[model samples]
Target: MQLDEATLRIVAILFSLLIGGLLLFSWNSNRVNRELLVLGSSFGSAAVGIVLIGIASLGQSVIYLYTGVTLLFFAYGGGWQTMRIFERRPVKPWLAGLGGIFWLALSLIDPEHGPLITALAVAVVPASYTALMGFELWRGRGEYLPSRFALCMVVGLDSVLLVMRGVFIMIAASEAHRWTETQLTMTLSLLIVLVNVAVGYLMLSLIKERLETEQRAQTLIDPLTGLGNRRALHLHAERILRRQATSGQSVCVAIIDLDHFKKINDTFGHFMGDSVLRTFAERATLKLRPVDYLFRVGGEEFLCILQAAEERDAVGVMERIRRSMKSYRIGEGTEARGVTLSAGIASSRRVGYDLEDLTRAADAALYKAKRDGRNRVCVYTGDDTRLAADVEGRAWAEPRPQAGPLSGPQLT
Candidate 1:
């Protein structure tokens, strides 16, 4: 059965309003998230546009019809902006507002000029928005978002359908609504409403998934140095260990502590100490392999895991980092110093020593390195059982856990 324009308008209004309510509820849950606000605005504008079109269907002014169509284009433009904001791209609201202005201008000129003469010109505005949004989603499909490819297809198909409708209207020999009142037009109208509701749900899911991913990252990341925290280290190390069990590859764990950190903080202030930590974090990561993980396990301490063919290869990396730290400077000018660090290397040939055990062994070796003098690498050779026992007996022997990123530089 073919539905009339009035029926299509009513269905569109209800669907748009439902989607708008969903987005509004999402926004209400997290008012601080700007992306939710944008999504809500998009659906809300679409709902208003559908309402206006429905009113004009029941014998309102033609201005209501034109404005409704323009607002519909504006609503789609908001979808484009919503995607951009979700991807951390800049949004230009004026550019979107211009789409409505373009339609309004064409509508105003239609009375003075011939309506048919400007009909094609008026059709181009919405077509342009739909095409641009489709292209953007298509072009950026696999860049970052997990749901990008699906979005690309949805928007792309919508753009093609809208353009097809415009083509039929522009070339039609009959008067207004001649092509619009056809079976194809009704089908497209109902489909557009249904697809828009689906798109709204998909977009909301994308935003929520992206937000959850970000929240997880923040939970496991060091804000200052942008490295993994102790929690991240433990989580990833277990995964690495499981992989190592299958491959029989040696995994090396290193505990790194800055030398004379208290002196650095005392002489140069905590800011300079933080600069040293960031510098070390950058240098250490650059010097390590891509598969390796570097984490700021404590204020002035870092933990690294090397998945290598042999334990000696890991030792080589730790030594390289040690030598690199010897000449590294924290500040550029008068506040600069050749900051140094000490690291303790431990290995796990099998599953006997887990992340905690490896860390404890490395800590023991690290304490010895600090005692023997700073600015050197110490490898655990299974000969530190006495010190390991001492460390085991003292509950507070290990460094402080990373307390939600490094707030202040450690004294020692």
Candidate 2:
């Protein structure tokens, strides 16, 4: 119940060191996360600054006080820089050093300033940095993180407290020299210790949540093509269908198979085959609208979901992608060859909103495209009637094979 200023400062120092060591240990496990490194350094610097401030208090030396305050400024700067790193923004080392530089300049210009001025100046540094950290987190609130809002609130509250403390120092300027021994200082130190613990825990939670999200995303992404995998399709299809149901817009499902993909793999090796797949993915992505989704469901096979597009629109988009692939050269120096893709499209108007039904219809039309000729687009019409588009962009009707229990390469 009777916590002295020295005892509170010691507790603060111990907490900083503990949090800093934990963050550094975590960073050691994953060295690529520079945010952890910067954050840990911030806490480490804070601990050193507190120790120096304790020494200054014992000796009653302005040099140690100023130096410690400067270190604390850099520590706050490090906190700001940690936010920038978390948001994937470019690091500005000069900006991070600005607070320290400003404090040092103030010390040089007004070496004989009263303790009130010094306390106010020190408060300004952490207040500005914490406010900036809150702003950075606010800007990144669009990202779904459970701990982000809590971190923002904590930082914002700390900033307000620091500003209020500065105001209190100004109001009680006569007692400024004995500020550290006051009850307010003791309370502030305890608050800093609590804030440090909360922020450290929240930051660790934020990092863990982010890593887990990315890991889940990786599982649903094709490593080679960088497109969504089948699992992604399964997850995302329902959302697309719900939107389509509400808007009453047609959704077109297209099953695309890389024509002669096996031959290319056999002739040029798997590396070149991979290059071709990546190239196709790039070209197809360029031709489709941002609202559309493309997934690599199987080997040399892809699925495209066109939002708010009818059958003809889907066919035209697929045709553009087909032509683009036709122009791309796989290899050079006499071994060069062009690639082509065949896509079968099925509209939600006819096939309904079910993903499985649309996939089956698209697969049927895709089979028709492959059976008729490669490098073409086919749209499934109810019954045995199918509309096929040739390389010349001419559409013709062809009889569909008898409907069996949804055959050939299930989209599951």
Candidate 3:
């Protein structure tokens, strides 16, 4: 059974209000998600515009019709801005309102052809906004958002439907002059109700998915140094070791300790200590290869996993980091202090692919470096019997010449 024009419009207005209210409630729970609030207002404006247009249909008031059309323009523009805000782009209120301003200006200047212009604006303006929204979602597809593609598809379909409706109205201008009372307009109103519901739910899902992903990352990230924490270390190590086991490639674990960190803390204060940690992380990250993983395992302690690397390769990386830290001066001229770091590297060739075994071997070598001298890199050489001889041999133990800045891509 076909519904009458008034009934379809009333249904559209009610559904829009319901979706708007739900979005507003979601915004109330997470005020940081301002996109939700903006989208909700867009729906609210659409609902109010539909209501005014419904009343004008009964009274034949040109002023009310113009006001309602302008509001609808603003409503669609807001929808477009919502996508921009969701993608972390700056909002342009003037651009968002440009559609509404254009409609009002055209209505005032060309009152004779107001109906034709109104129908065209209704078709073109909303389609433009929906198309823009779809494009914005498409641009952000790299972010791993689940509902993003689906929402884009929905908005694309909405734009197509709007353009089709406008074309139909243009072809049948004499019949479409009573814009709100036309059969095509009623059909569009019902389609809009469905679109509003789908878009609202999908947008909320997108926001929720992103928030959950970030919260999970927060648990594994060191906020101070912006490095992976111990939890991330274990998570990444498992995958790296499994891959190494299959490929038969060497994986080196390097346990690093900042030399005289306690002295820096005791002398300069914890604030300065924090600064030192951040600086060390930054410098070490720059010196390391992109394939390597770095993590903060404890206070003034860090771990590096070098993929497909042997003891010599691991030692080379550690030495560069050691030298980088040694050259860096903290604070100003008089107060400036130099910092050094020591790293102990153990390879899967000797320690096996087990993360714990590698960590233990690297830790032993780290203490051995500390005992021999600080600011040096040491390689794990089997048990204690071989350790002393290996240290004396200084085969791969001797420091290599300071290489130029690392050439390949650095870790993020």
Best by TM-score: 2
- Looking at candidate 3, what is the lDDT of residue 171? 58
Pairs with backbone N, CA or C atoms under 3 Å apart (clashes), candidate 3 = none
Q: What is the C-alpha lDDT of each candidate?
A: 0.71, 0.82, 0.83
Clash count for each candidate, listed in order shown: 0, 0, 0
Cα lDDT for residue 29, candidate 2: 97
Summing lDDT over every window of 10 consecutive residues in candidate 2, give the lowest-scoring window: 402-411
What's model 2's overall lDDT?
A: 0.82
Model 1 gets an lDDT of: 0.71
Ranking by lDDT: 3, 2, 1
Residue 182 in candidate 3, Cα distance off native in Å: 3.8
The candidate that wins on lDDT is 3
Q: lDDT by residue for model 2 over 281-388, one digit each (tens)? A: 877777776567889999999999989887777887788788889999887899888998888999999979999999999999999888887788888886853655
- What tens digits encode model 3's per-residue C-alpha lDDT throughout 1-412? 6779778877888888999999999999879999999999999998898888878888777777778878888988999999999999889878878988898899799987777787788778989988999999999997887799999999988898888777676556656564444577558667867986899999999999999988988888889988889988877788889998999999999999999899899988999999899888877877787678888999999999999887777877787788788998877878887898878888899879999999999998889888877788888888741232244322434333324322222222
* TM-scores for all predictions: 0.74, 0.91, 0.89
RMSD of 3: 4.2
Candidate 3: where are CA atoms >4 Å away? Answer: 175-180, 331-336, 384-412
Q: List the residue pairs that clash in candidate 1.
A: none
